[model samples]
Target: MTVRNLPPVSELTEQQQRGWSCVWCAAPLSTGTAINLGEQRHEPAFGSPYWWFPRACPDARACAKREVTGDRR
Candidate 1:
């Protein structure tokens, strides 16, 4: 599925990168309840490339709402 471009990895929290929270809203998400956005690869300037998993709530609208309003849940 298509999704908006993710925020820069440097700006994301550990939970967001680990798929434990919504990437956009920063809301906690139960396993199997979030939509996997797929693994992302990052090539740092001084280290080997690494991958980070990103997930989001099933309801994109709600996620966006929470993001815009700063309502993390």
Candidate 2:
């Protein structure tokens, strides 16, 4: 699957709602097994960081990548 970037600078469309769909697997974002990368908050920001676009779910990672190699954080 091709990884696409969700541009944050653009206005939010109805499809952007959290309950809409996942960028990777097209699953509902509300699914218990799904996750969004933006939720991680890697960088400090007062507002929704524009750089944190194309939110991804945990299932987006490949099965081989599920195993942590070095960093747990």
Candidate 3:
């Protein structure tokens, strides 16, 4: 079997810009806010990428979970 690598967020199709929210806690993530994802904690990275979690928040776990679980509460 072969493993196919996925592209980075920079390469993915851009989605509509929306307010940042935590995947696990469903809390809104903003600048200087702390977001916990499993074993890691994330802080916001402000730059051209706009709103994004730090490297510690790999794979956008919170975002993915929301997609898969369809929790629009």
TM-score of each: 0.92, 0.30, 0.25
User: Candidate 2, residues 1-73: lDDT per residue as tens digits?
Assistant: 3455553423443344342454434344554655554532223346554333334445546421432332212
Error of 1 at 61 (Å): 0.8
> Going through the candidates in order, what is the number of backbone clashes in each?
0, 1, 1
Number of the predicted model whose TM-score against the real structure is largest = 1
Number of the top lDDT candidate: 1
lDDT of 1 by residue, 1-73 (tens): 4689999988999999999999889999989789999999999888899999999998888888999999997
User: Predictions ranked by TM-score, top down?
Assistant: 1, 2, 3
Candidate 2 lDDT trough over 10 residues, lowest sum: 63-72
Against the unseen true structure, what C-alpha lDDT does each candidate score? Answer: 0.91, 0.41, 0.36
How far in Å is the alpha carbon of 5 misplaced in model 1? 0.3
- The order by descending lDDT is 1, 2, 3
TM-score of 1: 0.92
Stretches > 4 Å off in candidate 2: 1-5, 8-13, 39-55, 61-73
